[model samples]
Structures are given as structure tokens and as C-alpha cells.
Target: MKRQQPAQIKGLKKWLDPVYSAWTSIATHKLRSSLTILGIVIGIAAVIALMSIGRGAQAQILSRIQGLGADLLGIRPGMTMAGGIRGGFGSASTLTLEDAEAIKEQVPYIAALAPTFSSYQQLVAGNQNMNAQVIGTAPEYMFLYNLEIADGDFFTDYDYQRGSRVAVLGANVKQTLFGDEPPVGQQMRIGGNIVRVVGVLKAKGAVWASPDDAVIIPLTAMQQMVTQPRTSRGERVVTSIALKVTDQNQIEFVTQQITDLLRSRHRLAPGADNDFNITSVQSTVEALKEATGTMTLFLSAVAAISLLVGGIGVMNIMLVSVLERTREIGILKALGARERDIWGQFLTESAFLTLTGGIIGVVVGCGVSVLLSRFKVMTTLLSADIIVLAVVVSLGVGLFFGFYPAWNASRLDPIEALRYE
Candidate 1:
């Protein structure tokens, strides 16, 4: 005669009652619940922070390497063995200005080339003197190295041909010598030899090599004033050559052609080792990428250990929780609650605890990452995928570790649990 609620509806309400009570009970023991969640929070935070740093570092490295120019190729003097002994393993003096000219004339795919020699010397401007690297290079070196002229202009072919003692200051060198004042047309002493400052380079942030710590001068001036001429031994000479290729795809072909040409010119016998090394920008980039990946994996592994520890902590706490709430389980069983309902209730409580901790950990981790990036300690990129993964992992931990305790509680004898005190 009277309207009756469906049995399923009544059962659903009864099932949810234990979950609600468990949450409230946990709230009553705030300190214990907080302590239990601390491990998970720290673990998640560590994972997030470490992953972000790794990604940021990789990005920074790749960007710097790419900035060197995609078409760049570097040639360095290679080791050579002679008379059954290592004779000229040092830098080869055979790579002269003539080699640079030969490469340009012979290699059709080569867009530009620069032969460079470097030495460290004291640079004096008025009363200010500081030790800085002096690089002897042609004007094309600027474009090959992606250097921009901030003021004035790079040395012309006339400067190289006439052996002008003109110099260009890198951004840092300019600032250190002249401060905010214009440096062009100023006379500076490099290794006690007077040289005119013809240009100031734009500021390029520090990379694998600091671009700001050097002064650029004509290669002829470096040879005449800075480096002592070799008498008999051909060991002292230009260190490297930079080549800009016309096509990225032709890098290997160009490298092989150059090697063959140099080997022939050097008169090395067939099957004998050549005395030069050629490196490409792509190879450098690949090496950097691989190193970054290794670093990221190592850091992530270390952080994962913490997550594993957190999972074990969750399991231990859930077991303790089941033991402590034995009386509650018995009362619920006595009140006609089903075993499945008891299982769900305990499982839900564990999940809620972990999920709450995970959310908090994500926020804290992101905040820490942002702060670190702002301070230039490392870069942090928080992606949507990482956030989703953190939450999923946290929920999974709860499910995996909470199951045993939940099942044990659900299977307890009501009479025995009721008398468990």
C-alpha cells in the first residue's frame, strides 16, 4: 500500500555510508592521516621535479648546438704515426691558409669557409688590461659561427689581404674594456702589439663554449704578432677550419671528398692514416642528445625509487588502518552490509587519501620547478601528459596496495571482529 524505495537504491546508500564514515574518521585522526600521506607526496613531487629538469636540460643543450648552424662542419688536425713511432700526433701544421683556399676552389657544395687560429693574450685598452682569447679568422668566420656585428662592421677581405692589425671585440670583451662606450675605431694593445678595434659583436649567452670571452682579429695579424713562426718542426699552426656547406644532405659526401683531397695533398700512402679530423654539426648535436637522454633516464630512475618506497608506505598504512578499524567493520557487517560493500568502502578511502596527496604534490612540484627555472638553476616544462600520469600512478598505487587490506577486512568473521576490541 505504501510507496517503497528500490532495494538497489537502499543498498547503494548503505554501501556509501561506510565510505563517508571512513573519511570522517580519518579526518578525526588528522595527524596520522597526514603522516601517512607524506611519503607519497614527497615521492610524487620528486618525480615531477626531476623529470621537468631533465627535459629542460635536454632542450637547452639541443638549442645551443643548433644555434651553431645546421650546415656547419669543423676540421681539426688529426694524429699521425711515422717510422713505427707516434711522431706527429699533435695538431698538424700542414693545414694552412692554402688548404682553406683549396677547399673553396675544389668543393662545389661548400658555401663558405674560415680557417682559424687561437691564442690567449693580455688585451690592454687605455689602463684596463685583461687576459682574453684572441682568435685569428677571416671575415667569413663571423657568418659561419653565427656571430652578429653589434656595431661597426666585420673585417673585410682587404683587411686579411693587407694584413691589417684590426680587431673585433666579443660582447663581454667589449664591455670589460670599454664599458657602455662605443669601441669602434679605438686602439687596443693585444700582447703588447697595437691593434685597431673595428667591430663589437652582439651578446651571445654562454653555451658549451663561451663566445663572449674572445677577441677576433685577422688571421694574418695573429700569425705575425701573436704566434711565433715555426722553424723546422711543423707542429705550431692553425688549429681548425670551419666550413659552411651548401646543402645539409651533402654533408657526408663533402666530408669524404675533403678527406680524400687532404690525404692526397698530404702524400699519405694508401691505407695509411691521414693527419686530420673532420666533424659535423649534426654529429655534435646527436652526441648532445644522447647524453641528455642518458642523464634524464638516470635522474628519473633515482626518483622512481622514491615512488616505490611511497607505494610500500601506502601498503603498510592501509594494513594498519584495517587492523585499527576492525570494530567498525564488524559493526557495519552486523548492520547487514555486504562483503563487496565493505571492500569498496575501504578501497575508496585509500584512493581518496592518495589522490588528495597526489594533487597536492603536483602543485608543489610545479611550483618548485617554476621557481628553479626563474632562477636559471634549470628549466622545467610541465606538460599535460605528466600531470595526468602523476594522478594515474597515485590512484594505481592506492588500488594495488589497498586491495589486500580491503579484502582481509571484508573476509573477517563478524563475531570475531566484533569482539576484537
Candidate 2:
């Protein structure tokens, strides 16, 4: 037991000796050590801050997409080609109210469906007038679009069935038309018809075709105002159809089933191109996530360039340190210090410098992120993994850059070092 105790004590001393020597050397040249640490600090801080911004942007995109309802699927009429000039999606009136009804009856796993017609129209409330996207849809549209009433009640099925001229206002539209005052019970004019405001929707943030800049009315009422397109069988034409799935897991399956059913209903020949376009909110979210993830990785890589610069500074300083301590290394060797001891000490000094800087940089970076979010400049998301990455990266840079200097110091000749001035 006594023999083993001596060996353990020696091992402990060997490990701690290098750390103590490194600290002493750093303290002796505080200014130089600080300058070396400052480079690492800036590098690590830049990495953390830029990564935080990238992550925040990714989160914002995800939030906005999820806000659109994960189980939602949007179907729009496909393009029309005339004289070889192809029009954009929704230009052709290939879909009808009967198609929507057929899907509601045939397709399984459907929670709710909304067939809609939309057009740009001038809305006038008192003397306030502005051009806004006007949507004509049923009450089910509220569920499919994930809309919430901020002020008043949405129109009911009774209002829809009777084609009552009731309207719902989006947050931006309400703000522009009525400001802070309640807009419910107010009357607005659309085209030549007068409509009563029934509700106001909450702000959903800006996205492609933002609902915040739209006004909603019953589908039947919209047909009366606009020049309604009709099928050969006299079925009313619709611009788009939005449906929600009962189970989020069944979204892909339901989407395929909808495609097949729509193709069959439209009587398109086999292998022919579809006259409709379908978009899955879940799939869209995944695509956006992939794009954002790539962007975040790119931003992180750009920020890491500073870390390379810092590492070069560390290598420069370490080489200078080795040159200045050549005589000291020789004296230690003459006093019976081993080569490994010198190597360990210099490497420990380099690692300690970077590790300290890494910690300080983390604190500074977190402070910057908080300030950005608080001031509404940008949103930031910091995770435990990021801090761990910073520590590991900083330590890695030190070890890699400090190697040559540590080796050079360790290889000095004891006789030559002892004779140095």
C-alpha cells in the first residue's frame, strides 16, 4: 500500500506541476497574456453572436410556418398556356365548388375544408379607403387558416348559407381603416355592395400572401360582386381550396389521395399534367427548415474565420514565448527537468489562455444577444451545445497552434541553454 501511495502522489504532482508553472508565467507577463487572450475573445464572441442570429432567424421562419397550421394543405388552379405564353398559378379557373364538395365527401382524414375566391378590391370605411386583398370563403376558413378573432365574432354558417354580406377584417386592414376603435358593427363598401364588419383577426405576421392585409366575406356574396367563372355544368369556379387533416401524421397520405381524386374528378387523361397545384404546410415547413439550417451553418462558418485568425495570433505569441524562454528552458533541463515537462507547461499555458477567453466571450456574447432581443433588433437563441462547441473549438485551436512552439522549447540542448546570456 505504501509503495502504491508514492506512485499515486508522484502522478498527481506531475499533472499539477505544469498547470502551476503555466499560471506563474502568465502572471509574470500579464499584458502579453491579456493581448493573446483578447484575440481569442473576439473570435469566440463573433462566433456565438453570429450563430445566435442565424438560429433566431431559423426559429422565426419555423414559427411563422407552423402558425400556418401543420396539417393544412392548399390547392390552387394551375397555369393556362395561350399562344405558348404560360400564365402563373391560379390564372386558370380549373377548380370549382363541386370539386371541393366532392373532396369533402370522398377524401378521408379531412377535419375541415374551405373553398375560396379572392380578388384585389378597394375597401372604404367612412372616408378611409385602401386597396386590400378580399377573400370570399366560408366559416371553416377560420380553422384552415389558423385565424383567431381579436375583437369580435366570425360570421356563422347561417350568414354563409343566406349569402349575407358580413365581412371580417384582418389586423392591418382594421388598423388602417379604424385605428384603435372597435370596428365590429361598422359598415364597409366593397365594389358596389355594402358589407358589415363582423370580426377582426389577430396579426399573423407577414408571409407570402399575408392574411393581415386582407378582408374576408362570404363566398356566395363574392360571386355576386365579381364576374363569376362557371364550368360547362354551371358549377361556380373557385380560386383555391384549403383543407385541414384530422391527424398530422396522415398529411402526406391525404395529400396523395387528394391529388388522385382531383385528377380523376377533373377527368384528366392518364400521364397528363395536373391542372391544379397542391401545397402541404408540413412539407413547406421542412423545406424552409432545411434552407435555414444551411444558412445558419454558412453564418457559423464565416464567423469561424475569426477563430483562425485568433489561432494564428496564439501560434505567433507561443513561438515568441519559446524564443524568450530558451535560456530558462536550458536552466530547467540542467536542473533535471524532463523534455515532457517543458512541453506540457507551454501547452497548458496556451490552453489556459484560450479557455479563459472562451468563458469571457460566452458571457459577452450572451449579453449582446439579450440586448438585441430586448431592443427588438433581432431575436436570439443560445443553446448549451453552442457554449460547449465554443469551449471545445477554443481548446482545439490552442492545442493545435501551440504544438510547434512547445516542441521547439522541449528540444533545446541543456549545455547550450546553460551557456546562454
Candidate 3:
């Protein structure tokens, strides 16, 4: 045991000596070392900041999509191709109220559904005038969309059957037209037709499909006031239909059943495309998430180009370092230091420089992210895992870029280096 003690101490010194020598060399050339580290700092900070913004955007979009409920399904008119040109989705007036009724009666596991249409119209209340989206839907729309009434009541089935000219105001519409005054019982003109305001909806902030900026009226009332095309069988064309599945697990099955029924009703051949499209809310959410993820990866890759530039800077600085310390390397080699020792020392020096820069970059990046979120300039999400990844990548870059210079330093001939003035 006593004889082995000296050998263990020698082995420990072999590792610690290189680290100490590397630190001493770096400390001796503070200005040059700092300049080299600046490149790494900029690269890391850019990567972290851009990644945080991407992640935050993805989260916000997902939250808005999921707000509509996971068990919801939407049916909309498909695209139309005319003269070899394809129009955008929802451009064709293919869906109808009869199709919605058929789905309601035929499809199983459907808790509720509503046929609806919308158009932007000019609204006038007393002396106030503004343009807002006007939605025509059945009485079941309230339940399907999870809307709540803050004043008065939503129109009833009797009003819908009678084609009553009553309307419901969204929070923004009411505030704009009445401004602190109660909107119920007041009259508003929609497209030059006078309609009575029977109810007001609660405020639901900004969302993808929120009715906060829209007005709701019975479908029959809108059909009478607006000139819309009808099917050959006298069915009124509708914009879209919203369906609520009774069970989240049954969404796929319900979608399939609706598709088969609609295809049969439209008399579409087996090889032909249906005139309508059915999209489940869950599927839409997944698609959006995937798109956002791809965008984030693309932006991160662009930012990584700067890291590569920083690695090149590391290589350049290490090469200059090898040239400046050639005589010192010769003295160490003559004093019994091995080539591996010289290699390890230079590699340690390069790693230390990058590792220091990475820590500072993380601090700067986090501060910038917090400031952006604080001032509402943009949203940002910084996770610990990303920080760890940035640091590890910086270390790996140092080792990779430092290889050639370290090898050149280790292979120097003692006589040649000693004579190199």
C-alpha cells in the first residue's frame, strides 16, 4: 500500500497539471481569449433567443386550438377547381342545411350540431355605425359553441320557426354600439334591415373562433334578409356545420360515419372526391402543432450557422496560440513533458474558453427573454434542457475545432521550436 501511494499521486498529477497549465496560459492572454469567446457568446445567445420565441408561439397557437374542445368536428365546403385553377378551401357553396340535418339524424354518438353561415355586414345603432361579422345559426348554436348569455336570452326554437328578426350581440359589438349603455331591447340595422337585439354574449377575449367580434341571428331570419343560392331541391346553401361528439374517444368513428353518409347523399362515385370536407378538432390541432414544430426547427438551423462561424473563430485563435507558444512548448518537451500532455493542455484551454462563454451567453439570453415577455414585445419560453443543450454543444464545438491546432502544437520538434526565435 505504501509503495502504491506515490504511483496514485503521480497519476492524479498527470491530469491536474494540464488543467493548471491551461488556465495559467489563458489568464496570461486575457484580451485575446476574451475576443475569441465573444463569438461563441453571440452564437449561443442568438440560438437561445430564437428558440424561446418559437416555442412560445407554438404553445399559444395550441392553447387557442384546444379551447374549442377536443370532441368537436367541423364540416365545410371543399375547394373548387375551375378552368384548371384551384380555389381556396370554403370557396364553394356545396354544404346545405339538409346535409346537416341528415348528419344529425344518421350519425351516432353526436351530442349536438348546428348549421351556420356568416358574412361581414354594416351594422348601425342610433348614430353609431360599424362593420362586423354576422353569423346566422340555429338555436342549438349556443350549446354547441359553449356560449353564455350575459343579458336577456338567446332566441328560442319558436323564434327560429317564426323567422323572427331578433339578434344577439357579442361583447365587442355591444360595447362599440352602446358604450356603457345596455344593448338589450335596442334596435340595430343589419344590411339596411332593422333587427331587435334580444341578448348579449359574455366576453371571451381573443380566440381563433370566438364570437366576441360577431353578431348572431336565427338562420331563417338571415335567409329572408340575405339573397343566397339554393339547391335544385330548395335546400338553402350553408357555410359550415359544427358538431359535438358525445365522447372524445368516438371522434374518429363519428367522423367516418359522417363522411360515408355525406358521400352517399351527394351521390359521389367511389373514385370521385366529395364536395364537402370533414375535419376533427383534434386532427386540426395536431396538424398545427406539427407545422409550428417544423418552423421552429428551420429557424434554429439558421441560427446554428452562427455557431459554426464561432467554431471557425475557435480554430483560428488556437492556431495563433500554437504559433505564439512554440518556444514554451519546446522548453516543456525538453523538460520531459510528453506530446500527449501538450495536446491535452491546448484542448483544455479551448474547452475552457467556450464553456465560459456559454455560461455568460445563457445569462444574457435569459435576461433578454424575460425582458421581451415583460414588455409584451414578444412571448418567450426558456427551458432548462435547452440551456443544457446549448452548453454541451458549445463544449463539443470547442473540441472539434481545436483538434488540428492541438495536434500541430503536440508534433513540434524541440530543436526546430527552440531555434524559431
Report backbone clashes per prediction.
1, 0, 0
Our model 3 lands, by Cα RMSD against the true structure, at 2.9
TM-score of 2: 0.89
Model 2 per-residue lDDT tens digits across residues 52-164: 98999999988877877788899999999899999999898899999999999999999999999999999899889999999999899998887889988989999899999
Point out the higher-scoring one by TM-score: 1 or 3.
3
Looking at candidate 3, what is the lDDT of residue 139?
94
- Which segments of candidate 2 are over 4 A away from where they belong? 1-11, 82-86, 179-183, 206-209, 231-235, 332-341, 411-419
Compute the lDDT for candidate 2. 0.89
Per-residue CA lDDT of model 1 for 35-132, tens digit only, reads 76787788788878988898889888888888888899988877645565664433446666667777889987998899888889999998888999
Q: Lowest summed-lDDT stretch of 10 residues in model 3?
A: 1-10
Off by over 4 Å in 1: 1-31, 79-94, 176-181, 226-237, 267-274, 292-306, 327-348, 374-378, 403-419
Model 1 alpha-carbon miss at residue 150, Å: 2.6
Error of 3 at 50 (Å): 1.9
lDDT scores of the candidates, listed in order: 0.84, 0.89, 0.89
